[model samples]
Target: MANIAPPVEDIAPDALLDASSSLLSEHPDKDRLFEQLAISADRAAVAGAADTAVGLAALAVQVLEEIGGEPARLGTALAALGRLEYERGNPDLEPLERAADLCDDLDEPVVSATAYAYLGAALVALDRPGDALAAVSWSLAEQERVLRVQPELRPTLKPVRAEADRARGLACRALGRAPEAMDYLARAVEAALPRTPAQRLKIAEAATLLVEDLLAEERPEEAMPYAEIAITALGDGFAVKAALGRQRLIRCHLMAGGLAAAHPLIEALIEEARAVPGDLTFRAVLADSLAQSAELLPLLAEDGGERAAERGRESVAIYDELLAAGVEAEGVHTGRAAAALALAYALELCGKHADAVAPLREAVDTLERYAPGNEQLTGYLARALLMLGDALVESGQAMEAAEVLRRATELEPVTTPPR
Candidate 1:
């Protein structure tokens, strides 16, 4: 909610409902609920608690009970609270399950449907795809049940339709069914985008996750445009966005073999690193981007990529300092990521393939430990494995090289499938 767009009154209800609050025709103090969510999200960001999201949502629920259970407030509160939990990484399904029961008690179709949307996302995150699928199905079931009993609610259907679409799409993605996922996610994006503040956030988040999956499948070209839109949508003031933007930009440039254009950005990123909180992952990503840009420099210049590589190396050194000073998991992941890329280039150029193995292996271990399930770290993994293979071959270990390459190739292909 901290970086989320402010709600606009004139937009369609779907865009409106998908955000910090939901639409309930009966609740008083509903607006206050939205404001509280915003404040809590912002506070949680700086505080960085694992349970900050749930704690904030719980507070909202307490406030709702004081408002006399206006139907409007109830639905709106449930939607907001549900979405917040989904973002906070709560996958228990119990919170959402209880929310659905609350909506059912009030006989609110719109709220009921949206609750299912929340349920679907939570189920997916928890790795219960079938249940996630069933939860969405149940949500639709509840929606129909409500509309049949209360025909008056049918008119405000756009956001509900869109919400359902987004939820279903999320389930598809979790199933690893990309084609179905793409179709559903695209519709959800269309339905929720530019309208629902919450939905747009979902669209942006989904797009980012999808692009990463695509890239992991090694389909950079397919992921490129999504990554671009995602970066733009991420706006400013969000540290994660800053890191993701540079990551895709550097990658796209590399895929296009346009190292020159990437050079200055890489330089700028290194400089940018100096000003940011040393512990932030953004600095680490900047460091890695610098390293990647440096490695590409040789492909575009006569002087070789060493200059950029050297600058990147310097940036990496700063990240090292931050880590030594007790940098968080974020710093560890990003620093490891940058170091891995830089080390690969350094070892390859210096003909020290044997020595390169240790750093590459360490990079892999560090990234896996600190940034598990993260797309960028996955990229680092791919790069490290490839480098190890290259080094093994360089050092007259063709058998080992072949084994490594085979493993890298296998790991790389599934990550980025065709759009």
Candidate 2:
């Protein structure tokens, strides 16, 4: 009898697992079991049940290994498992690496290309940019070969091409090859034109990446369109990526001196952020957004200083709450310090130098305590010290100002021409 795969989408993961076990014991059709498990795993992943997805993917891999006839199937299973693991934040590279090797042993260029592409993305996430570049290069080459033979597959492979290009861009950017990175990123954006809902999200992601790279390179004008594209493509989605796209759009407006345009978006962002429940990271992002908005407001309108100060206060308070809640993640400390610095800037803009002094001091102390001698934080620390010195001087503490200025100068020397 031929093996028939069951409809996995209609079943709950627990029910599917139970059914799968029963079928395996009664029928023992390994291929059908593997297909059911893999399809269920994909469905669970799409539904955001990551643990269930991973469990199902592992079972699929086990079934494939026991069947052991087709290297391509095993390779695909391993790649799927690795991708799920990477998305789950566990990121084991071995499976992706092994999958790439297994796929390479077959004459299936499309499967090999996809496996290599997955490996490349996983490598990029693991910070092995050199390996990522090589893997993606292989993937792209295989894709080109497949395209040469099967020209009809172009539309179907566009998303694959976009993903490979995006990974290539990221790897090139990490390797400091700016020109190549920009080219690849542009290609990714071009290839990711929306054909479906999933494709629209891909377009938003690609455009967001392009916007980030453009902004980092001090080309906000170039970034603006991509930022707009990302925001527009994201539509009504309240996911973190959607929020990030909106934030980047606001930043593009701010950098391009369109403070009026940024103001309303910032307000909407705050409102949206407030609506999000039980997400500490999103709250932290909201605090940072508030700080940026506060900084922008002082230059925007006549009553801007007062509104800026209020926003600054709110930003600082949020950071305080986060810190008090024991959220000791990677950027939380730095973000807290930045919030204090922004609040101090807002106070100084209001001509309350005395009021600014305390926050400036807090900013400096936060950095010194939490990230002592971190080279990456040295610039922020130095800027905090300089601002604190200025506030001290304005507040009639010339002696303390001189001491703080000396520390700032020691951390980041200010070059002066000979008189």
Q: Which number leads on TM-score?
A: 2
- Each model's total of backbone clashes: 17, 0
- On a 0 to 1 TM-score scale, where does candidate 2 land against the true structure? 0.70
What alpha-carbon RMSD in Å does predicted model 2 have with respect to the real structure? Answer: 6.1
For residues 128-212, what per-residue lDDT tens digits would candidate 2 score against the true structure?
Answer: 9999989998999989999999999988777778878878887898898988988988888766654433445656766887888
lDDT of 1 at 321: 63
What does candidate 1's lDDT look like per residue over 1-419, in tens digits?
Answer: 32334533333323333443333433345656545554564345334432554555555665566566665565656566666666655555665676777776775667778778778877777778777778788777877786788777765655565566666777787777777877776666555533323334556776776676776676777777776666665554455665666667666656555567667766676666656764456556656755665565655553344565565566567567657767766755556566656656665675667766766666666765654576655666666678788887887889988987786775543242100
For each of the candidates, the C-alpha root-mean-square deviation to the true structure, in angstroms, is: 10.2, 6.1
Error of 2 at 62 (Å): 3.9
Q: Cα RMSD for candidate 1?
A: 10.2
lDDT of 1: 0.62
Q: How many pairs in model 1 have backbone atoms within 3 A of each other, for residues 3 or more apart or on separate chains, i.e. clashes?
A: 17
Stretches of candidate 2 off by over 4 Å are 1-10, 28-31, 64-105, 193-210, 225-245, 276-283, 293-298, 302-306, 319-419
